[model samples]
Target chain A: MVDGSARISQDPEPRKNNRVHPVLKLLYKKRWAYYFIAPATILFCIFTVIPVIRSFILAFQEFRLMGNVWVGLENFKYVLTDPVFHRAMRNTAFYTVVMVPQGVLKALILASILRNLPEAVQTFFRGAYYLPGVASAVVISMVWKWIYDPNFGLFNFILGTFGFGPYPWLTSPKTSLTSIMLMGILTAPGYYIILYLAAMKKIPRELYEVADIDGATPFAKWWNVTLPLLKPTTLYITITSIIGSFQIFTSAYVMTQGGPGYSTMTVVYLIYNTAFRDFEFGLASAQAIVLAAIIVFISVYNFRVFSTDVQY
Target chain B: MRRACWVLVLVLLIGSLAVSFGSIGAASKWTGTIQVWDFPRPAAAEEWELQAFKEFEELHPGVKIEYTKLTWAGGNEKLDVSVAAGQPPDICGSGLRLPYILQGALEPIDDFLTAEDLKDFHEETLNAVKLNGKYWAWPWYNTLYVMYLNADLFNERGVPLPENGEWTWDEFLSAMQKLTFDRDGDGKIDVYGFGFTFQPTYLQPFGFIYAEGGRVLDIDKNEFILDSPEAVVGIQRLCDMVWKHKCALPGAGGLTTTDVNNAFLNTRSIAAFVDTTGIISSFEAHNEKVEKGEIEGEKINLVTAQYPRGKNGQPIAAGPGVGSWAVFKQKDDAKREVVMELAKFITRGEGQKEVVPLIGVFPSCKSAGNVWAGNKNLEHIVPAVEYAVYPPMHPNWNKIDEKIMRELQLAVLNEKTIDAALKEAKRQIERLLEY
Candidate 1:
């Protein structure tokens, strides 16, 4: 890193503006770069940053068509006591807890297997695995809804062929959350696989060869060399999967509508229902802020745990 | 130069002549667009809407109408966002409840109509859209829930049907239990006596509650009385039908209105179901299929009956599914006038005749009823108009409805006791009322 900085310092063309103020000279030198990024920065601020800030403000106010009024802690009080909110939080936690580790482990295994395959075969399988991720969540939910239909779904039909009776895959409360979790585990691991595969490729072949020279088995080499080196990638995948699972909404909404008695209700789905369906924007914003805080806390904790000795 | 100027004048004159000749009756004095957000209807069902738009646009040449069709699935959410962002459409054709909930955001249309013109609408239909003795919207048609019975199943089981299209809840329960049986003696019940989803429409339990003289809100006192004895009785009956009797098909807790409708209409697995008058179209199509030898079973003889009477002995009163065209409070008076003009045009004689039939709803206009007189389906719902109950009007009624429905679902699913569910619902509704 120091040698790279020294090489850039030796570039004579960039050092010619020594008379101007240092900050001004630096700004001038990067003017075209700033200009190139201005559109994206402006768009991000307008769409994302503004709404996020506004939501934080809204969390402390009451929304009305005529005007908004400040109502600090009131919305949070209501949300905290809300029975549906409690159910949503519990359901969301269950989904995240069950889905994240399952997704990360599945992706890691698949990526490890793909790493040993021929380049062409790896590419083919990578595309195949990533294909479903390209489909919109709504579309995927709709297709899964059909597959989970109690009477005439593909799952029930296959079950019937084995002399077992039809099963209500999504309709029954006992199975609804499990069915949705299965979908989350399936849909979430594809992108993680690609990331893990890229990270695996970056690991030096010398490490594995050193293990091989030490008379290690293939599994031992993978465990002692490849797995240890993939720590940063694994941490990234786990944190992201946890966040994604916590926001499970589309499947529950499109398929069950948080129904069979709110068995599949997640925090994000509850937020949508409270905000849009019930027209309680302040309460919704408070719920979202609480959710964001919970996510941040969990993610930070995960970073401390999984990222303790991450090399690279 | 004089010759060239004369040639240009000749060209201009020809162009003027062409414009005047081509746009004979297409002259429109009004200019600007009227944005509309409407609940999604089948594209084929909007033939009259399309025709009216064409006629309106032709007569008002410079005027443009930008129509947005919103699906019922997420339509209320879309409207909530639009209204929150202060960009609601110039006109909306949603239910009576939503526009009323929007309060000052809607323009009262009483000023746009004369007493003589207003008298053309059914009083019950008008009452649904009126708040503070002023009309917020002009009605297009009325939708009411009525029981559709399978006469074949009733006769086959030798179970007597409701007399005079009316029966008490006791009689209704007795009939349903008798109608349910194990065919082929296989010990599995092949036929369900009734089918209905527990979705929170003001169709079933609310209808039953109203029949018993109980209500969700006392408009005068502004209090939620959902846990009243009469309301509890109505909800208990519904819950018992699922949890205790099991007369309905199992897993009805998850069925949509369409799912139940299909089970009753096409599959014949369900003996009866209560739904909107629009199910007449499905019944007619089924009858057509039977005539064409496409279906081999004994023909389904569909009969429309009144919803069962509650303890007070009055027939169930369904909330009027009044499809109303509400005008938003626009800044421009000219735009408001155009919106009112278009609304009046649609609710009146010729326009009403064209639209009401496609909608499969009973006409709101007294004169428009004549256009559907010969139709049997329209005749069935005509009696329901008198029995149509207006839902409690409040700006927070939608939220109240959601809470009530969610709790009712929990009760029906055995997630909560009937008393617990209704109590929680009442608490939530009271809190909303306080707001």
Candidate 2:
């Protein structure tokens, strides 16, 4: 492999004469590296990248089995003007605004507590918290649906015991979207916790020692030393978490069905119904592009506010 | 020696070519895979569900049916995606919704459904299968959306059964009031007399909406007419049961069929609810469990009743009124014929007689003729099919349904007045219909 590649790369006459493309020459020089990742890259292109490109194209075409008709901006115009789509956008924005912070905070609290525990205890607790992420979201939603049931649910039963009124957790328009948001905050913050844990372990132990010598309390030490150092990781988790929040579907689809009104309908659920339920694939694709653009805008805003650079 | 070898090779080659041409000369029967996606019917009908697949395979060697099990909750999306992917099953038991028709994905069965076979089908059943006067599916069974009353609850409350399973709006309201009580004298009401789901995608509320002289749409003119006063009063009457009369369960406006049914079965707190004949199988199963002592309770004495009369003066039933089978478009005519044959083998002749009764639904074919002739549970609703109605055959039915139900839900929850909700729904639907 080295003999063949070295011969090609070392021969600079073709490159100097502009016979070989610069990108191709560079790829040829790194042929072994390319070969190692080629399979995965090909698969990713086929499954993810191509479909995304096609979805963008589909946004401007009326989809049909036999053939698709070009509809220009009609699909985008319809989705923007539709009241239901507006509701979905508002609901998605709410999820992003509310759940993302709660999620980051919960993970921070969890990782901070667990890192101080004995290794054995830490391992056990981490595994326990991570168990839910391994389970199907659809299955989790079904369990939550029962917990939120108005008359016979666990929440109502608990309230009844306290001589409080039964709340329509998922059934009322006022509370339905909040119930869905509450689920996001309440579920085990396994993924984020793991990320925070790994980031926390890399902080120099001497930073804490210096803080202790300065007579700083544990809270002050954490606030001054741990959190600022974890900013890069926090920024990463926050961006990803916001993306996840915007795409909330399985739970809403299973629990309230975006109902009582269009209260709980999120952008992804609307896209799904438009494409699959109503067969308006072009409109669904347009809605999806709008959702992607919103996520991109928010992600950029998050970076401007949270991203940090540290030599360490 | 070389000449002899060449002659021998030529003789063998000619023999092979002659045999190949001989086989190609005869008309060959087509055989391959016939794909099917179906929801779980009653476990009682499991045998019937697989029976046609088995018989079709046996009758035509090399023909195999690949079956995929689908859940009722998720099946619509699955079917839609499959159709959009141009990979729908050759045989599926989805209703003749207009979306598939407009996609030109379904193969109309008119050519295969003969005139003799046509005579046996109910006109309503035929109409349900037809759009633009072309029949698109083979009707297997028709289900009526009627009220199911727990007779035990009725008796314990000393409320008489609807006389002849018929009640006017006043009588219905009075019975609901009498039956609802705080059983343990707790501050909270223990059981509701009547409960109805107002979710979109379900036609449970439609029976009442159309109970009076209200029709959802005039299909001939293609208009959204629910804002008409007749429909408003009909919807208002239901809203009153939840808000004014307080005879229905809490969360009735947004609850699911499963929610209300579970409340009735497990809590024993719901006396009456509305559903299609498909639910009869579920009730029968629950009864079986009760008899076996696996469940704790008296066997729910399920009695079928019609929705109370509105100003229309006759009981009304409405829903996705009929369940039928359609063959999706196929690449080969011979395979299409085979798929149509399988559809016929499942719905008509002996097929309807065997499958329809096991599932406890009324047959679409008149010749299948009262399979539940003496069953007390079906005594009233079996005849109520005559009054059954369905949604207008709109291509945008799902969206239209969503809007209408959202408005109705707001009305039922007292978030909006019935008139306002209907007017808003009509205003939105007119624009959608224009599209």
Candidate 3:
């Protein structure tokens, strides 16, 4: 460390001669950097770090009408073996698996298609597709609820035109989860399309022009140039989509209510039920920690797979 | 730059000082302002709430009330968040479950009520809000499950009107079969005989387990008694209504409150199974729909009766659900006294009389029942109240209800045998009781 500092001091121009003390000089040079970082650092510690530590401590304590009691890992043991917890895990896993690939593929295709359109038309289409992402989940879920109505829904009306019998979209245990997943896939691809489109726009036109001169078709250009350039955005979207899908509560809470008999009872919904509905906060917190761990593991795995040997 | 920095520091210091003093100022006054949290109900109830507030301000000259409405579906979570933030409302409406008390978010009101105060309220209503020998709330209203019938359908089919509130399994099945009809001769049966919901609220009939000489829990021992032979038989009979008898409409377990209510209102179903609150408005609003001329050569009437008796011959209504107001143990003695006074004023006979007619909510005071009966519009609810039973006061009641309701649904859906489902549910409830 001393040799590195001495070599910097031995520069030909003698630029360091006016420095009173090395430590003071270092502080003065990076003062603006410290100022720029202060707000986010304070906020992150107060909100994110503090709550996580507090929730961990709360997981071991039994909260009841009288007071809290320290009860070691009893809460963890109970949550792991609880039937509702098991069902929630299964449902959340199914949703994550279904939503991630479906969301990414559709967003990719839309982004590639939007790339070829004129700028004005492209902006209009992008905004149109992105509208669902901007709309509140509560509003969208309520509207979709009416659309899934068995007797009077637009879906059944359309099916009737083809002479199909009425389908109970949100009522049947068999179809409820798939019906919700279809809605998620449709509504969530908008933001990912915007991300991928932005990344596609940043790629130099020269690469695509060379591909065209070299007799590359549209499919080949998308496969070789567009997809490779969009790798970083794809990784970001994949991780976020998996995390978002695992935390799905609003749809199930509003529409199916974890039912047609627990078919849509996701992990976060069970945590909510255990904590608020049943007042089992200790168990709820333990389940939440497990859920958070699962999300982190899955996200890390996705990042490793998509981040290997990739550059913009 | 130095001047701007001084200005930023000055602003933040002043903000902190204001915050510190503002809380102290708030702590010193009754301020005549109270915050209330309530869920939106039907338009009539909303109107009644506004009127009640208007009357309250006139009676208590300086008090000002602000009301915030929450959605029924998310009210509990909203209340939880408020409590966690330590800013719970001065007054709130809650369901009988009252999750806050169980979770340690509520303050007991025992010290606020005197012995004389306790004597005036009905024992059953008081018992509903009491936990561990301390009263947590003032009981507001009550609801129970009752069987509503389409009397005109009974007359057309020549079936008896379910006398004595008792029917054997075969008799109930035969009556439903007679009520089913395909009026237009289409392949489809346009009108179902009986419509029932499979939600947790409807599982009240499972209370027949007790009526049939069975126990849900050995109260003294805290052991689950759901696997007892009598209890199994009672549950099996409920599932048999859907699976074995085919008396109820298909997909009945999946039907929601809206679905069943619409079926009855549209006259698509003859005999409807619903709570007393469910049919009151329909019977009042569309009396003409069931009138003689509306259905050429057919007449319709509305009647309600207790649920049918099991083999034991005793008809039991599952416990009535109750709602109540709880006074928080305020840190300030004067504020606490005022809150207690507010609770007493809302629950007194005069208050009950003022609100009962507009809201149709049952009175918690026994004498208030007379007020209920005197209203010609509310007279029908009296008989239902006569048979009301409060559910067991266990903190785990909601969890147990969820498990049993799921088992009942599985049996109704034919996904599992009745015995198997009952056995699993029994095991689950036993585990919960241990906790």
Q: First chain TM-score in every candidate?
A: 0.90, 0.91, 0.88
TM-score of each: 0.78, 0.83, 0.73
Error of 2 at B90 (Å): 7.8
Tens-digit per-residue lDDT, B1-435, candidate 3: 999999999999999999989877655645477676777756776677777777776765667878889897888777766775667777776633455676555667787787876876666567678766777887766655666677777787788976644565567668877777766674445556677655654554554455465656654466667778877777666667666766666565555656666666664464646565545665665666546456432333666656555675555555456767765436667666566667677667666665655555666666565655544334544544544556556678778877877676667666677778778888888776754
Q: Model 1, B1-435: lDDT tens per residue?
A: 999999999999999999997676344334788887788765665666767777888777688888888887888767766776788888888734443355578888988888877788877688778766678888887777778888889989998877667788888888888777787684556678887766644355466666676677776577888788877887877777777887876656665566677677666777888777776877777778889999875567887777787665655557546888888788877678888988887677667776777777667777775555665444544655655776666667766776787777777767789889888888767777864
Clashing pairs in 3: B319-B389, B320-B389
Cα error, candidate 1, residue A5 (Å): 27
**lDDT of model 2, residue A228:** 92
Candidate 3, DockQ score (0 to 1): 0.14
Q: Write the per-residue lDDT of candidate 3 for residues A183-274, one digit (tens) a residue.
A: 88667477888999899989999999999999999899889988888889889988998999899999988877777677778999888988
- How does candidate 1 fare on TM-score? 0.78
**How far in Å is the alpha carbon of A223 misplaced in model 1?**
3.3
Q: For model 2 chain A, give the 10-residue run with minimal summed lDDT.
A: A303-312
Candidate 1: count the clashes: 2
Best by lDDT: 2
Task: Give candidate 3's error at residue A171 in angstroms.
Answer: 3.7
Worst ten in a row by lDDT for model 1 chain B: B94-103
Model 3 chain A scores worst on lDDT over the 10 consecutive residues at A11-20
All candidates in order of DockQ, best leading: 2, 1, 3
